[model samples]
Target chain A: MMDILSEMLGYAFLVRALVVGALVSACAALLGVSLVLKRYSMIGDGLSHVGFGSLALATALHAAPLAVAIPVVIAAAFLLLRLSQSSKIKGDAAIALISTGSLAVGVVIISRTSGMNTDVCNYLFGSILAMNRIDVYLSVALAVTVLFLFILFYNKLFAITFDETFAKATGVKTGVYNMVVAFLTAITIVVGMRMMGAMLISSLIVFPALTSMRVFRKFKSVTVCSVFVSLACFFVGVVISYVYATPTGASIVIINIFAFLLFWLVRVLMTKRVAVKKPGLVLLMPLLLLAACGKSETAALPEGSAAQAAFVLEYPSQRGEAPAQAWLRQADTQGEADAATPVIEIKEKMFITQINDIYLNAGDYIGKTIKLEGIFRLEQYEGRQYRYVLRYGPGCCGNDGNAGFEVSWQPRTPAGAAPSQKAYPKQDDWVRALGTLQTYEEDGYPYVYLVLSSLSVLDTRGAEFVTQ
Target chain B: MEKDRPKDPQGIPSEPLILCKNLSLGYDGHIVLRDFDLRICAGDYCCVIGENGCGKTTLVRGLLGLISPIRGTIAFGAKIRRTEIGYLSQQEAAKQDFPAGVYEIVLSGGIGAMGLRPFYSRGEKQKAEAALMRLGMAGFRNRCFRELSGGQKRRVLIARALCAAKKLLVLDEPSAGLDPLAREEVYRLLKDVNRETGMTIVMISHDIAAVEKYATVVVTLGKEINAVGVGGEKK
Candidate 1:
């Protein structure tokens, strides 16, 4: 366990993931108390779905994703607030309608444009590898801003959440404070989406508050305990995910569920002393069972080093074109299309699938230099250590898909400045490897590989996962 | 209560603190009370008596400025901002389930008077404590509101109202669910508060006997202001 912990700590991505998780956890808990008390807890789910749709739209339009998503999700929050106030639609029903509709729209957009690849799937389930430096900085800035604003309006929020009518009667602009709450919640959801995913972000906003409420009766105590509990749960969840290779978002939510149950159990045990009554035990049973169902088989790393195997940079075989680009090259099959077709440039959104397609059909692009970025995984086969650039794509859910390209050093690094000299990346270090594409046969099947001209281990900590 | 007597700059005791002229009150464009006229003087202990759905609650709400009047003008006294008149709404829907202590609920009453300040000031806390003490609920300050008996909750709410009101208090059915003894106790407390401090009190109730015994003024409501009379007035 210590070995795994130390090894995991060596990677910058893991550190970035933990930091972002903590920031978001604290921010969510602070707002969660008010949101839960106000009966607007589901707004988190509503806004997250809106964020998913906005993220998909931004990805499709090739816009700066957060820039597009933040404003759109904030607007959706206000819209939900207005819709809930309208007599025609109830609050819960409004949330359900907006959330499901936005989720469906997001799914449709992803399927239409990105063709339902791993990148899109990551957004659904979340990937810690998605946290690059930009994301960390953004999360930190926004999380701090949210925490500050929440504290600035803490008392007013307490009044509004507990008794909005009374708060208004007491001369509070309850409408303005309500808007402030909604706006802060929207920001928390959108910023948290990268690490927690659209599907599970609401758990962070709900479970901590509920858990704290189970034991504490005072609003101030509940809020303070909620922040501490949420941050603790998130820390433990991240550590569990790191050690067991579990899905980060689900692990965090599962931890929160357990914390809630534990707090409830403590409450039950202290019932004689505390005079507390448990109201929702019957309703909680199935929910606890549902949370338990989040367990999935841990994804394993791929084995066998491609470095020992002789790689021929030249392809003697003719596979007309990569299957993804087959339609564009259909007319050129007779060998007259070299000059007519431009090289297919792989974008971040489609990099995983494109690299996979190129590997599966390695004959089309032999000498072309392709630039790709992913976590670096080092494995040993036949006494030769090989570093593979890997990425986890959407495969049903968080537990399943692993797709990546093997990096083959051109004029392989001299033995003197070998693995010992340069710290070979641990299992999940984000790196940008630029190399000429090569094909090598393993057993009998040919696989596309990268022959590195220059490798720069990218510092993409807090970076968003690629979603096309 | 003697030391805390209401300091009204208008020395004339008959001056109205709240006046409603030809008022129509209801919700959503449906008028419940039409052409209702009433005057509440600074030291009046007014008991508004009515049958169910006769617009007593609507009249009180309109007077509190919670709802707008359909036609007439309801004016506040010179120094009275709408919020300065403390109001205790009818037993809110399952408010006992709220996770607050008696002290917290009482302290919240002063939230409006806190202005832009985020935290309660020392003076506000002392006032809340004094309000609790006045209702003989100082011992229950830290007790959870949900665990309190219905009668205890009423006293706490009355204390909360005291925290908000500087000159006037309006309560709607403050003794609705209590037993007769608890109801009498609450009535006595209100009567004392009104008599000793000269804080104008308006309450909606069905207990005509209590109203006759405790009220300085009585306004009977039925579709409109049916009767207004001075009952057991000190003057």
Candidate 2:
């Protein structure tokens, strides 16, 4: 298990996901407390739906998903707040009205346009690997802003949450603070949507709060526990997704659900005992265990960087032997007599040696459809951009050679131009790409590349540096 | 116009702390209490007794400036601001479901005085501590609010109210769920605070017997608000 984990940690994309995921999770938990107490938990659910609709619109228009979705979702959040406040619409009805309506419009646009493409899937489910630079910078900035605003208004939020009437009578601007909560919630939803996905983002807000409430009876304790629980859940969930190849959003939510049940059972057991004065000690025992998983991940993360850097540097510099193809290819074909499928689905065990073979024997592999799953990389060398689906393999310099091929998207029509990189998966996404193998001559150097027919991110992760 | 006001029987202070003239209060456009006139003087222990739906809480809300009067004006005395007026409302659901400690709840009463400040100052913390001590709830400072019994929760909430009671305090159904022993303790505490601090108090209660026992001034709410002082003429 440690071997697989150490290998997975070498990738830069996973690290970025954990950092941003932790921040977003903490913010959601803090706001979730007040929202749950105020009976506004569904507002998160509503806003996430609004987020999905905006992401769909962004995809259709070929705009940056984060940029377009943030403003639209924020406007929708305020609108939902207003609608919920009014007497006619009440609470859940208002949310249901707007959420279903926006979802419908998004569905129509998607069906009429690209029709459930990879970008759309990334928003629907979460894809940490799908986050680009803008997504990362904006998420961190807004998460910090949300955290600062929360700290600035902590007492006011607590006061209003516990008793709004009293807070108002005591001169707290309850309405304005309510708006602040809504505004913070909107930011959290939009940023968290990238990691948790629109369908499951609100779970990030709801689960941790409800879980903490089960054991910690005080607001401060509940709040503190909620943060830890959220962070722990995200950490464990990401690891689980990495090892088991489950959807990241779904994995996090499952861990949250599991934590809530554990806390609930502990509460019930302690209540039966009647002698346990401090349940915090007993409850936090399991919480600490979950956090320890995160600790182990962080400790294990730095070990494989040296091996990965060597592999990356070695792969692009080495030359593939041109004459080893003729006899090796006929023998390789005879050995795999039943491998007549249109596409060769590369398995994890065969990932390294197979890609190495393709690089050395580019002519024999041309016109063959190969399905490969690895990290989608955009490398810049000599002022030129090259895209590849790659994983590390053992080379002369430890695990220093990248085992993958450069891939280019095929044009949709004969006369039409190929879509932009934004239309494909983002940088360092764990993608499953199917393409026809081909060779391109660049600067008098024969290079193996693939003309991609389809590309989409996978929640599954294999060994980052393979020896096979 | 000032000379026309009735004199107090105990001669504490003749100046009214909160004077509401022809006040109409309710939610939305509908009026629950209309054309009600009342005056509470400094150092007076005023007890308001009325049936359910008589707008006793509404009147309390109006006095605290939580709701605007539909037809008339409410005038506060020169020294009193709404921020100094401690308010314990009848909102129970949020309090029951809220996960807070007794001390945290009490400390939040200083929220009104924490203008532009993110947290309570040292003086405010001391004030909250003093309020808890005054109500004899210092022992329950670390107790979770939801873990407390009905009477204990009421006492803690009253202690919270005292933290913000600089000059005047208003409570709605503070002793509603208490047993006779707890009820008497609450009443005696209020009587002691009223006598010692000279802070004006307006409490809404269904306990007419307790009201007559401790109140320096009693107001009966029907269609109109009628006030009579202890051994004094109706005001």
Candidate 1 per-residue lDDT, tens place, A133-240, comes to 555688789888999988878877776776666566545677788888889889998888877889999999999999988877777777888887888788667766
lDDT of 2 by residue, A1-468 (tens): 466556555544456667889999999999999898888999999999888888888888989877888888888888888887789778799999989898888888888997765446657777554355556788889999999999899988898899888888877778888989999999999989867888899998899899989888888888888888898888888876765456789999998988889888888987899887787785465457666765675565544344345545643422343223343334334424534656766656436545644554455568888888788888877766678898875443344566787777752222222455535556876677777787666676666677776666654444566644
**Alpha carbon lDDT of residue A55, candidate 1?**
89
DockQ of each: 0.46, 0.65
Q: Name the weakest run of 10 consecutive residues (lDDT summed) in model 2 chain A.
A: A317-326
* Runs off by more than 4 Å, candidate 1: A1-9, A272-468, B1-10, B13-15, B93-96, B179-182, B195-197, B226-235
Q: Which lDDT tens digits does candidate 1 get at residues B1-235?
A: 1222234566545677888898888888998998867888787788888888888888888887767888999988785775676778785623344577678888888877767677888998999999999878999987777778777887887788888887889999889768888788889988888877778898998888887777767888774465454532322
Give candidate 2 regions above 4 Å deviation. A1-5, A282-468, B1-15, B91-96, B231-234
Best by DockQ: 2
Clashing pairs in 2: A219-B99, A310-A400, A311-A400, A311-A401
In model 2, what is the error at residue B192, expressed in angstroms?
Answer: 3.0
* Clash count in backbone of candidate 2: 4
Clashing residue pairs in candidate 1 (N, C-alpha, C atoms within 3 angstroms) = A118-A394, A131-A461, A131-A462, A131-A463, A132-A460, A132-A461, A132-A462, A132-A463, A133-A461, A135-A462
